[model samples]
Target: MRSLCLLFVTAAALSGCASVRTHQGYLTDPQLVASVQPGVDNRASVERALGRPTFMGQFDNNDWYYVGRELAQVAFGNPKPKEGTMLHVRFDPAGNVATAENLGLTRVVSIHPVGDKTPTLGRNRNFFEDLFGNIGQVGSVGQGGGTADNPTGGSGSN
Candidate 1:
């Protein structure tokens, strides 16, 4: 009985540490991708060799991208990228492959957003000040036509 319990505990611990791999986008096969020759292959030929691309360029239609990502997650933690590939294919005006670039995960750039606080123009105010600053002042609920003397209406004189 003790041995069985020990085995169960060990299995549970190991299970929690096991990583799950998640794949996103197209996976480029090295050998197949290598078959594409710049200046020789066109859009249709490249598609036949490497399958459909993951996405196309935003502003232009000549650039094609085949992006692939592999992420691993353990337990309930967020998945982290382990490997990735971005294959960029640019076609010339003649529709022939002009350039081919295979970028790896090392080329990725990560931008972290600013913290919770947002900076505004005026001086900083506390919670009470924010809630009660306009308590005594009066104005139309959502309108901005209020004046100093007539807080809820347009300027008194036309």
Candidate 2:
């Protein structure tokens, strides 16, 4: 009997869990924010209007992003958001409504960060210095005969 009680207690404890929370970034309740239009949505005013954003985006200080997510853990936890109709809204440079767009999860593509596209060049290397690395001594580059066997056009040896 004690073992059975303990088993029930253990099961109950195990069942209790912290629900996964997905912050709806950058989004305000649409109806709430929609009612706040056209009166100069400057940073402070907008914040006063929409509270705060979920996260800031890359290469943009003027834009705000709000994200609403579906909770897979529990029913009545969050709206499934109309399948793909997740709400995403963007603010304009002047802090007013730029545009509001809805993205369906079906159309949502995962983004992978590939790091900086520009190959890291020496910061101190001036333009002429960079030219030295790739362009070489004014006219030495590309002068050598082109062939896989003789990439630099030497006598088949270094």
Candidate 3:
């Protein structure tokens, strides 16, 4: 009984350390993807074959993208991409397929932010300065000190 209990605990610990695999975005079918031929396949035909694209181009509507990624995560760690596919389909002005390209994980870019606070080119103020910096600087509309409305600091006789 003690050996069986130890085996159960070991199995539980191993299960916690197992990596979880996830599939995100489009599910690619190599045969169907290869069937889409440029110039021969139009927008309607491509949509009929591959359903809908993952997303269209941000700037131009003529570009279509089918993105897929297989990610894996172990324990409490962040998920990392194990495999990725990006299918790009470009259409000409006449709506005919201009180009069809397949991309892989080579284009994936990992970005790390510099820090929590962004640095700016300005005066660095303390906590008190930030709280009371604008004191006695506002409500100068009628102080007669060369305001923006009356640049000459003269009476309103014009």
Candidate whose lDDT is highest: 3
What is the TM-score ranking, best to worst?
A: 3, 1, 2
Clashes of 2: 9
Residue-by-residue lDDT tens digits, candidate 3, 12-73: 99999999999999999999999999889999999999989999999999999999999999
Error of 1 at 106 (Å): 2.3
What is candidate 2's lDDT per residue for 57-144, written digit by digit as tens?
6778655655555534442364333332344446676666655455556656766678766577435566776566544344443576
Residue-wise C-alpha lDDT for candidate 1, range 47-69, written one tens digit per residue? 88998888899999899999999
Give candidate 3 misplaced runs (Cα > 4 Å).
Answer: 119-158
Give the winner by TM-score: 3
Tell me each candidate's TM-score. 0.73, 0.39, 0.74
Where does candidate 2 stray beyond 4 Å? 1-28, 38-40, 74-92, 102-107, 111-158
Error of 2 at 32 (Å): 1.0
For residue 29, model 3's alpha carbon misses the true position, in angstroms, by 0.9
Better of 2 and 3 by TM-score: 3
What local distance difference test score does each model get?
Answer: 0.86, 0.56, 0.90
Which 10 consecutive residues of model 1 have the lowest summed lDDT? 140-149
